[model samples]
Target: MDWGQIFNSTAGWLFSPTTIAYALAATGLAVHFGYAGLLNFGMAGFMAIGAYGYAISILTFGLPWWAAMFVSILGAVVFALILGIPTLRLRADYLAIVTIAAAEIVRLLFTTQVFDEYTNSADGLSGYHQGFRDANPFPEGTYGFGPWTYNQNELWVRVFGVILLAIAVLAVWLLMRSPWGRVLKGIREDEDAVRALGKNVFSFKMQALIIGGIMGALGGVVFALPSAVVPATYTTSLTFFIWTILLLGGAATVFGPALGALIFWVIMAFLDNVLPAMAAVGWLPMTPIQAGTLRFILVGVALMLLVAFRPQGILGNKRELTFVK
Candidate 1:
């Protein structure tokens, strides 16, 4: 129960690759549900495609890092089109059902023995970050100050992740401010009205789906930068977690998802550290394992309360929220 260790561990997540990954994924979710009113519950599936795509390309084809990244984004686009073709015209609930099922299917496929040679099934893929690391500008030494130091490799990953996040945020902001962005908002508000005004509602929806899915896929690749590609990491819970971040930050706003991700991870890190320390010190009556579960329970209750009281979220405009009838 060392206070210094706990603080450092919790603070580490503030700039960690995982935080950047969640920020990117949440941003994509914001585009899907916030601006376009698309119920894409398979964000994790898109991420898996990106992760596996990048990993397979690196391990098998020995593609360059930039090339592998482009392929991963391309993979996301193709997956989005495949998922959106028949489902976008269906009801929102139908899209949700299809997406959730599709994500599970993708995860299981990656875990199966058939593609184990390429995917490594449960063992996943590793040692794919060599090319990425070789391009680092930082010298081989620890960087950062105080409790926030990182080795050259970790710092390189963080820098790459931040650059991608910045580009994504800028891209999203620009897109959401243009005429195309206006059409997307209009579709979210009232698709029939947009259609009557000569807008191709279906086409716009598909484009939005593809764009957001690609973002999620890119996020997946970033998420796996510091770690191996594990199929178990892309589960239904991952999508739900991203949704929570989107809702917490205020969907539809350009920076809301990123802010939400930062906050969510910070809170989780704090709880992960504080709860265990409290239990260990007898400040809580529960064992350490029970404390771990309790933290999630607290987070669940907090989410429920947030939805019940402020469904529009922290940075969301209530006027922008419209459920299609």
Candidate 2:
């Protein structure tokens, strides 16, 4: 087995665009499920809208990069409002049903031929990041050492992504400390009690939904940096992955989701790289493809163990846990 290659692959995931994207998405889920007690099983829909919104705006309208990003966040907010208006009043399971279905609808809409001109359908979109890339300040040379180096563009992406992630974490931290945040936690604990105390529970829930959806949209934009806006990327599995990150880190904790994302990706990356190398050298008795699949099986088993032993997650407070009665 090539130990150097294995180490490089595993370490590369530390600043990978996928890691940043999942971190942001998990943070958003923490807001919805952790703070607001919302069962939002369709975070992928918000991400899809954000991705398609930015791609289509740049492709068809020729908008500036900043304008396109703003539009994407606005689109996610509007989508959240649409989803929240009729469904927030229903039972949690109903919200889950609507959200998951809505995500699928968004994915199919992007893949439909009628919107091919704007979305490029299943072919996806490119050339939209020229403006984004033009702003890179790093010189064209490799940076970092020992299993963690990147070219100018790659470094630029990671730097910008980390900046965005930091800002998001700080913003969430501040929000969770405010009076509004207190109300959100109260609502999470018991909406009826919050309502009896004269809080606008529905309005608060809608606002939380919008905020969280915007975060997911931002994640979608960053996620598309290293790749094109493929509709297939926003499948139900995407949401499930975000949930896993949230659960892994500790729900209701400000930094749990981000930490969870880092750990989850790191573990997966290690398994992916190491297991394949082992198989290649006959140290493992599996084919390359089987080794790849085996990583996920291992991750699934790990998650089961985590749920069984630490239901509150790495940083979650058991007192904050609330399952619907």
Candidate 3:
């Protein structure tokens, strides 16, 4: 059991690109399920669109990185409109069912051979990194120390992810403090009452869905920044992970989702390292393969416990989140 190696790996995830991406996505989830009381289960679909949109724009249209990102945002907006127009008025549970199914449909479409010319047909897309790499301001050198060390390009991706996350957090903070944010909260508490007050509940819900979807899109961009766009990466499990992060931090709080992402990944990283190490050292009664898979079981159990006992999450106010009717 190499404690040093485990610690180094765990520390690396402290500010990894993956953590930043999850933070951004979880913040969007907070906007949906936290402040707006929307049960959105299709965030994975938005992320898939963002990633593939950016990739296709670059590979097919020869668009610049920034422009490709913009196209991704537009794709998310269009997806939001398509998803929200007919579904926002449905009950929350129904919306969840529709969203989860819709996300699967999006994934399957990407996997299908119909768009193999662009999508690569489940082989996933790559070679889209050059445009983003060209924009890197970090010179060609190693940066940071210990587990945080990375080449210039890696550092650039982390910095870019952090900047996007910061902007998202700031934006959500400001919005949640405004009158519009208040209305979202009102609708979350009771949409019928807000509608009776002459507010367009559907419009507000649609707006929230769009905003949250944009956040999910940005998360996808950040995720694609450091790696290829793989269809398998944008499954329902990804949405569940984002939800876990949001719920772990605090649904309605501005910094909760980011905090949750950091903690969640750190824990996962720790388990990923320690579990296998324990099994290898004969400390655990399992093979390394089994130990590696046990982390997911542990995470599931932890989530169940959190929902049962601390549904408000680490930073959440119990009154701000209601898991039960």
Candidate 4:
């Protein structure tokens, strides 16, 4: 077992575009489920829209990168309205069921053959990232040390992802500190109480949904960075992973999601290498394939333990409003 390999792999996650994307998505989850008392189990749908919207805009209409981004945001807005208009007035559990179903529907729609010309059916979309690459300002060279290093193209994706994640975290922090943020918290605690005080609970919920969905959409774009947007990539498992990230970090805290993202990926990366190495060295009773599966089992057990011991998360305050729905 090579300890050096494990550490290098962990460090590689520090600059991982996927890490940045998950952090942003988790932050968006924090906004919806943690702060707004909405049970949004379909964030994956929003992310799929973001990536697919951007891809379709660029591929079908020859849109620029900025315009593609705009189309993505618009798609998220429309999705939020569609999902929220009827369900926001019903039980929160209804929203959860609707969202999870909606996410699957979106993924399936992309997989259908009817729009093969536009969506490419199950083959997914590629060659849409030229605009992003064209905007890269970095010089042609390798950067970083050992396995943590990347060439200019890869570095550009990481840089773009990091900048977007930073902007998202800052925006969430500012919003949660304002009066509007207070109302969100209030709704989370008890929407009836807020409604009695003349606040439009449904409207507030819709706004939060749209804002959080837009953030998830941005996260989707980052997740597609340096890679193609495949229909299978936006699975419901992705939403659960984002939830784990949000819960691991303090869901209501500003920096918790980002920090949790770093910890989660770094730990996963370390386990990926270390467990396989241990299996190969006969230190573990399992084969390399089994070790790969064991890592997730371990992470799941760890998450369960955290939930029992620190329900508020690493940075969450015991007094802060939590997601009870």
Candidate 5:
């Protein structure tokens, strides 16, 4: 039960690439539900397409990183269009139903044996990061301060992830302040009113869907940067986790989701470390397996308290924005 060890582990998440990736995905979710009021519950699917599309493009098609990234983006755009075309004009719940089903469908397809040659049949894809690695700016060495240090590759991913998150936050912030963003928020508040003002509500929803899906796809690429792309990684639980991150931060505001992502991971890290230590020290009457499960149970209780006390979240203001309906 070393306090220093737990602190180091918890602090590492402050600049974690995975956390940054989740932040980016949550930011996309913010754009979808916060600003656009679209019930897109399948962000995991978009992320899956992005990860698999990029990986397959590199491993199967022999494409470079840039080309592979483009392929992933294309895949996301096509997914958004397909998901939105038949449902954008209908009630928002339909989009949610379609997105959740579509996400599961994508996951199952990857898990099936039919596309084992391409998708590897749930074993996932890897060994395609060389092109991006060859472009690393940092020399081969450990970097950063104590308790926050990382190898050159890890540092590269962090630098790249932060730059991407900054660009996304800037883009979302700027977009939310523009005329188009205004309409999206207006639609969120009252779509029929925006429709009465002669704006094509369906068109705006489609645009938001595509933009958010592309962001999720890009986030997916970042998420799968250091690891293999597994179907299990793109589960409905992941989407729910992103939603929790979005709500933990300010949903309607830019950067909130990323901040929320950071906080969420930090809390989880703390629980992961502290709970095990407590169990080891006999402070908690629990086995190793029980300790692992307890962390999430504690997180659930904390979330319930947060929702009950401050549903607006850390950076969120105006409780009305928390209501999706």
Candidate 6:
């Protein structure tokens, strides 16, 4: 029940790599469901490919960090093509089914024993940090203030993540202001109308998928930077969490996803600390384990309320609500 410890833990998430990673992924989702109105539910699959692709390239192929990152992005592009080719034409619900299943397949393939040499199957891949860490330019020292303090390696990861997030935000902002972005939104609003205008709806959808998938892949790369590439991390729930973040922030807005990610993780971190402490202090009528589990229930309720009361999210334009359209 130490307030100081809880405060520090909560504050750390504000600048955590995981927060940046989720923010990136949510932005990708915003591209899919927000601007383009795609029903992609396999974002986790793209992230898995990025994380494992980077890890395998580094561990087995002896590639450097930048090369490995390229491989990961290429893998995401390939996955997007594969997933989008036959499925983009499907109805939204069908597309969702296909994507969720595809993501599970990707996760299980990594968990299977077939490619254990490269993926290490269930054990996942580790020891791939040397290349990334070696590229750190901060020199050996602790940095930052208060709960944000970290050693050189941690600082490097956070800095790189922030830079990547900024680049993504800028890229999305610019693209959305261009003609191509307008077409994407047009397709989202009325696919047949765009098609009647002689625009290739299918092509636009595919491009959006690939672009968003690449962003999701970048998110995976950032997520892998601070830890091993564990298959369990890319579950269907991860995609849903990304969706929640996307929806929580204003899906169609450029900065909404990042803002959503920051708020979501801060709340999660606060709950992770305060809930168990409350249980321990008999402030809650549940055991510590039950209290820990209750936080997720609360999150679910919060999401439901958000969806019901304000589906447009904090930064979203009410007219941009896909469900209403």
lDDT of each: 0.90, 0.89, 0.93, 0.89, 0.89, 0.93
The 10-residue segment with the lowest total lDDT in model 3: 316-325
Every model's TM-score: 0.97, 0.96, 0.98, 0.97, 0.97, 0.99
Candidate 6 residue lDDT tens string, 226-285: 989999899998998899899899989999999999999999999989999999999999
Q: Model 6 — which ten-residue stretch has the worst lDDT?
A: 316-325
- Candidate 3 stretches greater than 4 Å from native: none
lDDT per residue for candidate 5 within 1-325, as digits (tens), equals 7899889989999998789889989999999998898888999999999999999999999999889999999999999999889888777777788889999998999899999999998788899989988889999998989889989889888899888889889999999999999999999998889999999999999999999898899899999898789898999989988988988897887878988999999998998888878888798999756897798888778778877777777888764473723
Off by over 4 Å in 2: none
Residue-level lDDT tens digits of model 4 in 1-325: 6787788778888879899989988888888987887889899999999999999999999999889999999999999999899888878788889899999999999999999999998999999989988898999899877977899989999988988888988989899999999999999888889999999999999999999999999999988867899999889989888888888998888899998998999888888888888899998998998998898899899889888888788899867855422
**Per-residue error (Å), model 5, residue 173:** 0.8
Instruction: Identify the runs in model 4 with alpha carbons over 4 angstroms from their true place.
Output: 323-325
Model 1 alpha-carbon drift over 4 Å, by segment: 323-325
CA displacement after TM-score superposition, residue 308 of candidate 4 (Å):
1.0
Candidate 2 lDDT over residue span 1-325, tens digit each: 7778788889889889999988988888889999999999999999888888887888899998889999999999999988999999988888899999999998999999998888888988877888888889988899998767788888888888888788888988999999999999999998999999999999999999999999899899889886699888999999988988998999898899999999999999999888877788888898987898898889888888887788689998888878522
**Model 6 per-residue lDDT at 54:** 95
Clash pairs for candidate 3: none
Clashes of 6: 0
RMSD of 5: 1.4
Clashing pairs in 1: none
Native-referenced Cα lDDT, model 2: 0.89
